[model samples]
Target: MSEHKKGQPNKASPEKTHVENTSGTAQRARLLERLQAGPIDTFTAIRELNIVRPGARINELRGLGHKILTHRLTLTDDQGRTHQGMALYYLSTNAPAQVTA
Candidate 1:
């Protein structure tokens, strides 16, 4: 553990850390599965998959050596509202396998 000022509160509680790690892992797995089946947009991920932050999950998968691509496009939501500069995530066919240490 890194040392902080005497009055500073500890931010990394064991329970919070465990919950965050589990949530991130689950979200990344769900996103990867969805991407494998087909492309998923930000709105779809939020509405359908219950992933509020799809970009973060996608980045986590990329860090694990998955070749994920993003396509920027304008999209319409369920209420007919148009959103500009949206991202659609796709898994590339040439994604490399993860190397074991």
Candidate 2:
């Protein structure tokens, strides 16, 4: 017996939503750590980090004031298939130089 009406979208409980947010936070942390070591491609993020949406994580990092840069290029997958417009994310090394007044 439930009060949920038919044809209505199901909503996640607050606790479940918090868990999903925590998962996203963990994924963002992992992505940041990997980017520190070197550049990370979309395929590598998905295959290794288990992040289905690396771009969203990257955007979150950028929102947090991280200088992440995205480079677009072609990539070859394990199945010998080539993909165009692939994203390669890396931390920007060009910091603003300080000047004496």
Candidate 3:
């Protein structure tokens, strides 16, 4: 056993790199966590995560290779206000596949 040089790969050990966001971190984390329990809708996502631009965020996630499913749903609100909106669904049962260029 010997000490490895800086910037040199340790052939014996695998390498891992983790990147985080300063702002969108919370939204991304929340989305992933909640997706495990069940699917989440656009309105709920925006309200709960305080996401100013959910479309952009969803696009970013899609770019990252997340298989998010979206569908239009007719829902009634707390006051019985009914409306049609898009619902974003993520299946926690499916494992995340690596994105390939």
Candidate 4:
């Protein structure tokens, strides 16, 4: 006689399951790790987090009373492809001392 239940599969066998980590989830995890480490400059943090430019928009509603600003960032990937997109900045805090073309 089998040990299995009359209507159900045996408990000795288990179903396999697979889970995948998404790019966005992985990015957020990295971002949180960085933030817990210390205070870091926005640009450097953004680069380290592997965050692409186009998605980093500043919330206008939150920036209405502050001196926030935005600028385009150009980056070259390891494959030598150039990407262009906007990076948000806080004018009073993040503005660089020197201007570069």
- Strongest candidate by lDDT: 2
Clashing residue pairs, backbone N/CA/C < 3 A, model 1:
none
**lDDT, candidate 2, 2-100, per-residue tens:** 356899634333323432343776777778877888788999988887788999989988998999887777999989999999988888863223311
Q: Each model's TM-score? A: 0.68, 0.69, 0.55, 0.33
Candidate 1: segments with Cα more than 4 A from true spot: 1-22, 94-101
Q: List the residue pairs that clash in candidate 2.
A: none
Write down the lDDT that model 3 would get.
0.57
Which structure is stronger by lDDT: 3 or 4? 3
Better-scoring candidate (lDDT), 1 or 2: 2
lDDT of 1 by residue, 6-91 (tens): 99743443323432344665667677777888788899988876788888889878998998877777999999999999987787
Model 4 global lDDT (CA atoms, 0 to 1): 0.41
Worst 10 residues of 2 by lDDT: 92-101
Distance from true location, Cα of 19 in model 2, Å: 15
Local accuracy of candidate 3 as per-residue lDDT tens digits, 1-24: 547798974322111111222256
Which parts of model 3 are misplaced by more than 4 Å?
1-22, 77-80, 92-101
**lDDT of candidates 1 onward, in order:** 0.73, 0.75, 0.57, 0.41
**Residue 41 of model 4, lDDT score:** 39
Model 2 spans > 4 angstroms off: 1-22, 94-101
TM-score of 3: 0.55
Tens-digit lDDT track of model 4 for 1-101 = 33766887432111111112224434444433443443333455455555553133224312334344445667565577877763434344545545232
